[model samples]
Target: MPAPASAPAPAPPSPHPLRTRPFRLLFAGRTLSLLGDAAIPAALALAVQEATGSTAALALVLACSMVPKLLLLPLGGVMGDRFDARTIALAMDLVRCVTQLVVGVQLLGGTPSLAVIASVEVIGGAAGAFATPTAAPLVRGTVPEAGLQRANAAMAVAHSASRVGGPALAGALIFTVGPGWAFVLDAASFAVSAALLCAVRIARVERPAPGARPSVLTDLREGWREVRTRDWYWSSLIGHSAWNGAAAVLMTLGPGIAVHRLGGGAAWVALLQTGAIGLLLGSLVADRVSPRRPVLTANIGLATYALPLLLLAAGAPAVVVIGAYGLAQAGLGFLTPVWETAVQRAVPEHALARVTSYDWLLSFAAMPLGYALAPLAASTWGPGVPLTVAALVVAACCLGSALLPGVRRFTGGPDPVAPAGAEAVSLPGTR
Candidate 1:
């Protein structure tokens, strides 16, 4: 009998650079989109408060915006892996533009019904669920192995810039032309982002052959299974989950405490946010200072975040509080690039979107719940007590995660170029 046919060997992955044209365009688009995102939340919160005079109701509006993303994040990841990310991203941007435009019109034409505003926010959030996961895999596609760190660093800086500028700009717009103008500005920003994405052409790669189409439950199970099998994956997920949970509480309740209890309002919030801006500047310089030991550096930074909260708990004056907050944010900013690069290098490309989605889902799962609990916790335990506890919990999680064997030892050093016969993995669509 003739010899059995040999199985085909896997193909090698391609080499690419972080500074490629497509990546640059995508990065620019993301920065623009984030800036808009920042503006909308602040403007929306103010609008709701002005119309209803109910903090609880405004909280509900915010909850509606986040719930869809939290619920659909995993499914969104699957879609990214199954389709072209660029197409998904562009479509999502257009949808958001329309949603924001509608919102802008409603606000400009005298206040619309609260129901209408809430409905629009939920719709926009649904669109965001599609946009976020699609964008996760794009970084892997645009940059080469050696350049992943730099690419992630650049992205972190851009994200920080949006966070820093978005609210400030929104406040200014709201003060000058009303909330309607802020929403309009946000809509225009999304439009510009969509056009930029449309102008770029991303090369698609091959995907794994499908065996059987899995049910949604099965798909989720498979994703979980994949995560369970990786050491760094679980450690990173747990760490981020704890961090985000604590952050959710502080972000939701801290401002209120500062305003009502501490006799500081929007100005205090702005001061704290400005501190976070300083962190962004630090993150921009992180790549140049610590290119290789990102994980270790990030772990150290995570520890520092606790300091600010601890100081705030002690009733520090406004200047001291702002300085502490800035220090914490600067540390976090430096950590973001390192953490992103670690994840990109650790996970296989085929599974990257699924893993990222899972990461996001787990991390953000507690956010809405935290928001709900913050007020209750304050009522039960007193204002400063909840903030103190939340900060402590965050510190503990950071320390605990860093102590994990995988996280402590995992050094995704510069990966070598793929040799011949290696299989290349495809990144999910940008949509």
Candidate 2:
């Protein structure tokens, strides 16, 4: 009977080191950090609007915040890949703390000049560019490959929780103590996060072998090469770029549609955000159930985003609109962890920051364009028309990415056991 090949040695158990204390601390720090981050935008927006009474000025402030991220993200990624992520993250947090403290002080005194506010935002954004790419690699380094999905999922939950809670808190604070106090709160959160991170001990890995210290340009070139060679990477990137681009347009126009055409206002916006929060919850649950094949699942979740947008275009009521939005958010939440896990599994730890930065740069490149074009397009064709187009674009991107051969067939992580007739390529920088 040939002993039935002994079931291929049971594929060895996944090495997910979930019980590690440092990982738990790291996760707590991320949760607190993101919670503070989520509060900043809303608080800042309210502060600017109250001070300037100009939506255009508020928009400019937001733009300043985002523009640096788009410009400096790749460089930030390089930094993460080259240095200790723990150190980078701690330093960035400190920078953010100082920026927030300045804003809080100014707000408490009086409305500061727009230039000062914009400068602070720009600095914060630049700091964020350095912080984000480090986050994934730090998590990867803390846990085994088997735990990547769970770790990513835990981070996502923190992000979602922040997204869910931050605005509500900001709104409350803005109404009660005023925007400056909210900024103060954000500063405190960053302080807490920095302290937590300081307490967690991380074992540093040696730098890549001596000759492997490629120049920055060379490293960028290699990172680009790695991405281009992977069908899954390119396909997903293209899809998300299209999806986010269209979503940006929808975000700018949705308010007008709800207020003018649908006769809803702040209530509708709240509903939309609430839906996204619900989706985050659903995603957290999905991650706990299974860690395998996150790419395919993410693709599926992304496709679901189109549905709510389409329903909104079709003139759904506030409840239906909110429900659809929630569903999309949930789907996006599920997609996030899968994508993060895939990146960790495929990219070398040494090069992870660079690759992640590249990914963010390309993925977000279209956001500013979308935000800029939405108003112009709405003026010409009316708001509903542009929103409908955005919905269609999102649907098309999701479906198109799913059709990519590599994306469809991808399973999560590397093989735990050696496969027949395959030479194992050691992870990048490993001897």
Instruction: Write down the TM-score of every candidate.
Output: 0.85, 0.89
Candidate 2 ranges with C-alpha deviation above 4 Å: 1-18, 209-212, 415-431
Clashing pairs in 2: 275-326, 279-330
What TM-score does prediction 2 earn? 0.89
Q: Candidate 2 lDDT, tens digit per residue, 1-431?
A: 45554545557765444477778888887787777777777788878887799999998898888899998998898789778888999999888999999999989998567888899999999998999888877887777666777888887877887887888888888888888988888888888888888877665555666577778787677667667766777778877887788778867777777786566697567766776577578668756766455676777678777776677777877777777788888887887877888888776666678878887887788788888888998799776676777777777777777677677777765534322322333433322
lDDT of residue 189 for candidate 2 = 83
lDDT of 2: 0.77
Q: Which candidate wins on TM-score?
A: 2
User: 1-431, model 1: which lDDT tens digit per residue?
Assistant: 99999999987644333357878888888888788878887788878887798988887887788888888888888777667778888999998899889889988998756788888889988888878877657777767666777787888888888887887888898989988888888788889889988877765656645665556676567667667765655766666776677677767767866786566797476666767687787777776665455565676676666766776677777677777778777877887777778777766565567768887788789676677787898798876776687778777777777666666666765234332222336444631
C-alpha lDDT of candidate 1 relative to the true structure: 0.74
